[model samples]
Target: MNVRQDIHSAGVPVLCQSCEARHRGLCGALEPDQLVELSKTASRHGVSPGAELMGDAEVVERYSNVLSGVVKLTKSLSDGRQQIVGLQFAPDFLGRPFKSESAINAEAATEVSLCSFPRTVIERMMRVSPGFEHRLLKQALNDLDEARDWMVALGRKTASERVASFLLMIARNIEPASDPAARSASFDLPLTRADIADFLGLTIETVSRQLTRLRTDDVIRIESNRHVTVDSLSRLQQRCGD
Candidate 1:
């Protein structure tokens, strides 16, 4: 795994050259012309592992849609304790709109690529594009839904159960382009113990402990640090304490 941190010195900024028109997190109302204009406002870039995208209280000038890789959102307390607030996968939206500052910093959990769009441009385009406002509203609603679901995992689920739910959520969010196997039987583990700890509200030791339990139980096998072969997804789902 050539992590983005080492293989490249500088990242190349790419416009949204995809023929798919709108990327996954688009307001969903953008037309061809609107997309081109939106692309004009966007600049692609990459970040190394542990690189901070938006640090605490950083004014978000642009929002991004992940083209590849994973980003983790986290917040640290005054005592230096950090909590993983969110995990963003490819085709998912990033950045805060209309907010004065980012509540959490987004960091590359791994090497990452992003399509960055200027906030002002997006806001203007949304004003002109058909149904764009509604799409933005819906986007907010969807985010809220995900947050609430994870809140339950954090507040009530067991460690193993939390890991299972996280895996299934990531599986559903991963774009087909990002996963060639698409066999419905296998997927990858893109997060590290530290990453899992933050999102699952457990210690790194706890995450590692539960992962061992999962492996021993025939739930999964570690392909590498960044990959996992799911052996029994039904059983994995059941581990989520469903």
Candidate 2:
């Protein structure tokens, strides 16, 4: 049998066969044999919401693939105040490769699932697998681009636009594979109102006011203060002022 057939028949790890990361994440760059090797040391686990996955200035011993749910990245100031910097969804790599220490705190914004491997194992693979290294570089560049975009949003976007943009971001990332033609989505808000405000650089009251405005305009529907349904993602996108 050929390599592809061999991989399908037995080379691929059973646990990884149906994993989203295997198809969409860094593991996609690895060969079937490499996957089997990696799986020997890899572990799968779940984290509760608000739990810290990694803390700032901590030693970097492992990296993870976000299997499901949202991870919020934050940085703290000297006075212990924190700022929400970014969010990672399923299939996103979850650590800074080659860094000796973590520069940010990674916490579960929602109940999260992860597939993690030791840092030494991953770094060794990167040295030997050009494709794996290339994938890591690509993700890093994509993150930088997103950070720049968010900088613009925070620096210049109006409060209404920022809130809309935040909602649009959550909708797209939460259901990344949803049909574009449908233009609709429903999900529980992963972050609380205070957290959302912090991320968007707005006050909690301002966040609530904008959400109320969106609901009144029929752009979105809110139930139980956390459940949100977007009737038309296109309309929501229009509100983003992009």
Candidate 3:
């Protein structure tokens, strides 16, 4: 990742223009000149896997776009139990708008690169740009919908079904839209087995056993603990009861 320490680049405009999220996320509503202005206040950073982007209960004064990789949103109970509530992928916006602090832990699930700006800047942008605010609202609604769906999965799905459903979700999200013929999808699992257990509301042993069962059944191919290759998304989805 190109670290934007200076917050100014010789080709900032070009860089913003070529950004993957340029037309798909918050920046999509900005005009070319507006992008040029916004780039001046923007900075980019690469976050190592497992690092905290935002801690639970920490004051959040900045906003960011996930330029690449995944981030996990986690929450911990007073009794010390923690759960993985949601996952954020590339091009997703980070930070809660109109709020002063984070309610969940935001951790890098993979090597992540982000483009960030001050929260004040974003709030200001929303005030003047209806299109930008509208986009943010849309994103918020989508995130809420996903969260509710996952809640249902965690509360009602069977163990094997949960594992299969998890895999299907990851496969769908990680697959590139440009690759229509990618009959099989391969990627490293962003979360550890323990983390997966928390996310699926299962025990570590159960998660491992289910994963092995999936591999044995030819629903997936596990090259290593983290490396996973799904032979057929359709089969995985079937296992997920999709």
lDDT leader: 2
- Give per-model TM-scores: 0.82, 0.94, 0.90
> lDDT per residue, candidate 2, 54-165, as tens digits?
9999999999999999999999999999999999998899999879999999999999999999999999999999999999999999999999999999999999999999
For candidate 3, the TM-score is 0.90
- Lowest lDDT 10-residue stretch of candidate 2: 1-10
Model 2 pairs in collision: none
Better of 1 and 3 by TM-score: 3
Q: Which residue ranges in model 3 land beyond 4 Å of their true spot?
A: 1-12, 175-182
| lDDT of model number 2 | 0.91
Maximum-TM-score candidate = 2
Clashes of each: 0, 0, 0
Give me the runs in candidate 2 sitting further than 4 Å from their true place.
1-10, 175-182
Better structure of 1 and 2 per TM-score:
2
Which lDDT tens digits does candidate 3 get at residues 1-242?
Answer: 23344223543476586687786788988766567667777889999998999988899989999988889998989998777889988788999999998998999999999999999888988988898889899999999998888878877889999999988777766635224455678888888998899889899999999999999999999886888988788888888754
Pairs of residues at least 3 apart in sequence or in different chains that clash in candidate 1: none
Model 3 per-residue lDDT at 215? 96
